[model samples]
Target chain A: MRVLLVEDEVRLADNLAAALRDGPGFAVDCAADGLSGDNLAGNRCYDLIILDLMLPRLDGLSLLRRLRARGDSTPVLILTAKEGKQAIIQLLNSGADDYLAKPFDLGELIARSKALIRRGKGQSHPVLSALGLEVNTLEQTVRRNGVLVDLSPTEYRILEYLIHHPRRVFSKRDLLEHLYDYNWEHHSNVIEAHVSNLRKKLDAAVPGAEPVIETLRGRGYRMAVGPEHTIEPG
Target chain B: MNQVKRSRSIAFHLIAAVLAVELLSSLLVGILSYGYERHIHFHAFDSILHGRVDSVIGAVQDAGDVDDNVMLDTADLHVPKDDIYEVFNSRGELLGRSPNWTGTSAPPAIPPHRHATFSEIKVNGREYRLLTQQGSRIVDPGDPGGGKLRHVTVIYGAPTERLWRAIHAAVQFYAAGSILLLAVTGPLIAWLLHRGLAPLRQLATLASRVSADSWHFSPPASARTTPELAPLTTAMENVLQRLERSFTQQRTFVSDAAHELKTAVAVVKSSLQLLGLRPRTQAEYQAGLERTLADTQRLEELVAKMLTLARVEDTGAAPGLPATVDLVQSMQQAAAELETVAKLHKIKVTMESPADEPVMVALTQEDCSLLLSNLLLNALQHSPPESTVELRTALQKERNTAEFSVRDHGEGIDPADLPRVFDRFYRSDPSRTRSTGGAGLGLAICKAVAERAGGSIALASQPGQGTTVTVQLPLTPNPDAASQLA
Candidate 1:
């Protein structure tokens, strides 16, 4: 995947490029400031574009706006030194895919980047195929044996995040970052509430396999894959 | 420019000038009186000498002289006037003396030209003037020893005491008149000048009372009673009216700014409520709702900070709230509240050992908390996760200042950017994105709170090396001093 990086600070930009180069199947190009970043974004097609909000020429918000206005559907991830929540929300409202604050963990940054690409590719929708279980992204519908299942939006998001990373365990915080779109004040109960809802909806759709979405006790949730999945009573 | 307001009135100056003229004229009158009295004494002595000499020339036939010697009774030759006369034949000899001339100094010889000569001589511890004349008079103009007879020189001596006595009386009378003149005219001259200056005085009182809050400098209709003060009054009224307009303009600006901010805050709050009212799908909420909440929060913080800035700007707190507070205890309490946040970020905040005795400071409690909270919170917020933030307080004996400092080992600020950190809403990193949650008003408020407490706040930093923020306050008063304590 080819990614475009927009940052005003040369050193930080260079560092991010070096980090992104290590990501699997990724090629990264950098724009030193907002003007060139806007110009390049206007004319180019890419898998993903990384943006910095405090840019020298044109700010990230306006650039994001112009990109969206031109009907470009490329995923844009905002990276900024400012940690104020207001600015983050502004960027997200203007159509940024995801955001990472400065001095963030490199592993988290990479995970977020991959997640954004997966979302752009529509790969995050859960495709529960066995035992008549099915999840649809376009219609946002879940059905087992042609019967639709009702789930809240938060529950659907949790189910989708698990199904996307099949067999990989997710902590509550990871689910928060992946399921919800921006950083939020963390409350562990929010994950529990959504997880409970997702379990009820999935159980109503396909009654036998309770192990499909299993909680790893102190760890978190994971999507059971292959043949080892089994029904476990709550 | 307000000289009329500061100086004494023109009336007072005019009165002082007039009194000076009267005093000078009176002094001249006293000196001239003495000169006239001295002239009277000299003329009286000259006539007495001529009368005595004529009597002697007329009595020459009664002497029946035979050998150039005439014998005659000289008692009848004396003149009755209060003058002393002596006869000499071209020689320095005294032939006759008056009763009052017993101890008087004789006169010098007369000049040969029949003219009297006046001389000043001291007699009986006082000064006197003497006159002498020489004439071969034809006895009494009626008879004579012919036209030219034996020439007899006469010297007249007179006491200057009587002359001084008359001069002294005149000086006394003149001095008395001068005193009366100054006493009666001083206040009268002052009153006349004051009457002329009354219009200006009214103008001054009117102008002095004009202020920014009220510019009602309506000079009385009668203020132009004197034409001299009319132009001045008009000029002052013009200036005052202009100032009144400018002040009204400033007040309007402040009120408008306050109203706009209030409206913005209300709109943001309503918008947030609207976004939260509906049950949102996760994607829908993430797409828009969160951003709205963040913006609302930013608006709220901005409004609150602006209000605080306005409050701190408007009123000087009367120093009535002074109370002894233990700064160490205050910092410890504030640090306790911040500890939970600190632990989440893995940062350890610890208070350094305070002085041997509690560092008691005199300040309002609210101001103290505000001052310390801003410094400590800023340090924790700016530092890297897991970094240690230290709070220290000490009293400098010589400087009489109690100091509190917070040090953070984070990504330090650049030197050029440190000074601007205290300006309201001025963020060095302009984005003010969600992660920091700062409106950049914290430090500015801290500075105001510290100053209101009669203290000061300053920042010291080296880029990449940490930053230290310090506050200094005056120590509490000595409780042992009763006067100071009261």
Candidate 2:
């Protein structure tokens, strides 16, 4: 599993990178501060991101938000020496997948990483399909018209949630709760915005496919079941 | 120099000395003046006595029988209102005298050696100066009608009462003039002393203002020429200049040390980040060493906090572009951010504000934000689970102060530890544990920030009770003080 490690403390970052490299089934790269970490996460590919909250040029929360803004679906785990629960909650809400307080157990950290990677691939199930759009869990890809479509890690997660449960009417709140680790403010509107962006990408990839998401006016949004509801490029 | 050691400053001592000498000499002059006036009164009274006796003798020579025409009633003798006289015949009869004199007659015998004499006598409990003169009557020895024998007679007198009154009035006038002179010249004496020591006072005030930040202590040019005090002034100026130079050097040393330490910390942090990116050969050991990395990260945080505290404590100003912040809004924002933490801890954290309007303070928004964040964190960390932490803000109107207080329901600190809570590296619980402790720099940093904003911090706690940390800041633009006399 590939991971991006962001920390400003040089010795600790170096030592952590060395340890992650030596750990079984893990490949880790490092960035000194939040700004560099954001750049690397945006331009490159990684399975997971290890972030530190305190950095000189840019802080971890802003970096996490920027990475998410760039449409990167990498799972992010926050590392911090701060014990305040507010800091932890803020990092989670801003796009972090998990957080480990400083002086965390190494075994627990590895286990958490594996769990995050598993979740990032969308809770691998027996069979998954949404509104006639089908995804093979084993192959980690989606298909329409019997044509295979390559899906990014984040696209796979979004498609996995819709495909796992079909015609059950999932609201945006439910999707956000199940997809992200932390809660956002009700006024954030980030969930709807991200979903719209995701729908556009999915429609482009699989032409003439039914729209997966349905807006349930004033209540939330859901995945539709009708054949005529094909998603346009947006 | 030693004589003036009791005085606080040389100017004070010089003024005191001059006033003392002036007082002593003025008193001596007053007494001397009284003495001279008394002397003149006595001499003038003697001359008046001689003139009265000469007129009496001229009248007696023209009278044929001394007892008949020269009977010498004081009214008949034509003496002025202030003079009196007495006549004695050959048989020594009492003749006339002034109205206030008490005696049967002039003394019968005159002193044999002198023509005129001055004497002192007592009458009615008052001492008087008496002048006497002896004269022989010229007579024909063959004529029975003339005095055949020359009688040796006596005369006595008293100080001229009129002369005494005149002299007393003159002495009183002089005494009053002396008092007026003293009154008029007192401020003049003070002004003179002040003028004489103007350079010294200036030099003193200048010396007092010399400090580490600015160390230029040169005595005023006017002081260089003062003949009496020039040496002392020059010596003081030299000493002050030396002190200023030393202070400047010390301040420079401190600033340099802080800058170097900051650079070194940055370098270390950056270097560690670079080293962390390299590949490692030992997989099993890296797994085991992950915890050590966590500890190293904690160490870096501790170092950064310690350096910040040291720098803030050394210089009492925060290195920030400070601006006025709304204190109430900052507290509200902090609470909103920390609500999730409060929920997790099962602690109810609420902000209690006095007014809906924002309470403005002379601190930047970031500083206010940081201060509130730290205070809330401390409150949440220390308070018991499920208990409430209360944050309050108030304006202490009487003292012209603005105050912020955070109260928690935790295990309070020991009384002895309260005083040192804000000291660097001071913690109530010193056990090295991540769950319940930090590097003990939080409160120290908060204190430095408050002091930098012209404020103060105080902590009060009782065992088994709650703890309240209060920060007090002085309000600006004292309108009440300005309008007080209006």
Q: Pick the candidate with the highest TM-score.
A: 1
Q: Lowest summed lDDT over 10 consecutive residues: which window, candidate 2 chain B?
A: B477-486
TM-score, model 2 to reference: 0.36
Clashing residue pairs, candidate 2? Answer: A10-B272, A10-B273, A11-B272, A14-B276, A22-B283
What fnat does each of the candidate structures reach?
A: 0.00, 0.00
Window of ten residues with lowest summed lDDT in model 1 chain A? A177-186
Task: Give a tens-digit lDDT track for model 1, residues A64-166.
Answer: 9999998999999987555458867887889998987654555566668766866775565324343345656435566766778898766765665565446
Give the CA lDDT, 0 to 100, for residue B48 in model 2. Answer: 70
Looking at candidate 1 chain B, the ten consecutive residues that score lowest on lDDT are: B62-71
Q: After superposition, which runs of candidate 1 have C-alpha atoms over 4 Å from their true positions?
A: A1-234, B1-15, B18-26, B33-298, B307-315, B319-321, B433-437, B478-486
What is candidate 2's fraction of native contacts? Answer: 0.00
lDDT of 2 by residue, A1-234 (tens): 456788765555655565554442345667776677887787445668888776645778888888888888789888765555776787777888898765555555666766686677555443455555666654556776556766555455666656544445666656554444322244326667666776776677667766667777877655676665443210
Which pairs of residues have clashing backbones in candidate 1?
A83-B433, A83-B434, A83-B435, A83-B436, A84-B433, A84-B434, A84-B435, A84-B436, A85-B433, A85-B434
Model 1 lDDT tens row, B1-486: 699658975666677778888888878876776566556754665565456556654433323344233233466565555555555543444444555556335436555664766667665565655656664533233445443244555555555677677768877987898899899998888777777767766887888888886788888777765577778778888888788787885565454344334433433443443344346678865755565566567667767776876666454556554566777877987798788888888899978845556676775556577678778888887788878999998878698888999999977787778877776544566333223556557888888777766788899987777899999988877523322332
